[model samples]
Target: MTGGSAGAAAGAPWAEFGRRLRSLRRAAGLTQLQLGLRVGYHHSAVSKLEAGLREPPVGLVRRLDAVLETDGELAAILAEPREVPRRTGRFPADP
Candidate 1:
């Protein structure tokens, strides 16, 4: 994986992380809507996050860890090296 297409290839990790988040949410018996509500985001936000179309905000990730009862799992995922807004345009705003 190199050059132009390498960009897409690089997304695999985040995509997989999204999958894990989906599984965790489901195991907790929460729908995307439910999770989003808990995290103060729209259901579509959850969908995009789960679909890897957007990067999870750091705060959202922490909220999810609490909402989904993952006890830091989601936050741990956020800590991993991944492209931020510079490349993905989905980073959390500075606060």
Candidate 2:
């Protein structure tokens, strides 16, 4: 998950996104099961999303944002495009 460029940072955006989602849910005092029930997803599905193992649907993101009263931060984060690092098959120090 390391990016060749120092500015890019390691880990997938979705992984970080999932962490944010989990934090939001925790701050709102909602358990994964409860959030899933409110958002029309299974508990496991919510767990996966919060774990950054799965990409949530747009509808789910909207529902989560509304339910958590996050003022659209969650939705905005979910909507962001994730950039994969480009590999040129060269060593980092190669010129």
Candidate 3:
């Protein structure tokens, strides 16, 4: 992939993921308290996740997907780790 594409594919950080979660919740017309009740978490937990203070766990992601009827996008996003390029060889300056 081109550098730009590769970077884009690297998966979003926790903060962006949180924002997406919050947006999805809002689009579903659910408040944090209501969403948290559906997902079996506290309201503060949902708030922290939406605020980017905590990353959602896999179970939470799955619950969110089901609750929002997102057809698994949220679950898929949570499954991937942030991608990074692998180093193939030592630097030329290495002895």
Give all TM-scores, in the order shown: 0.70, 0.74, 0.69
Residue 80 lDDT, candidate 3, scale 0-100? 74
Clashing pairs for predicted structure model 1, backbone only: none
Candidate 1, residues 1-95: lDDT per residue as tens digits?
23644356347556766778889988999999988888899999987777666777888888888888888987887677866545666878999
Range of the 10 consecutive residues with the lowest summed lDDT in candidate 2: 1-10
Candidate 3 lDDT, 1-95, residue by residue in tens = 25664355335366666777889999999999999999999999997776666768888888899999999988777677776678979676756
What is every candidate's alpha-carbon RMSD to the true fold?
10.4, 6.0, 7.6
Query: Relative to the unseen true structure, what is the C-alpha lDDT of residue 30 in candidate 2, on a scale of 0 to 100?
Result: 86
lDDT of the structure predicted as candidate 2: 0.78
- Per-residue lDDT tens digits of candidate 2, residues 1-95? 23343223225456776888889999889898999899889999987776667777888888888999988988788667777789999788866
Better of 1 and 3 by TM-score: 1
lDDT of 2 at 4: 49
Model 3 per-residue lDDT at 39: 93
**Candidates sorted by TM-score, descending order?**
2, 1, 3
- Model 3 CA lDDT for position 91: 72
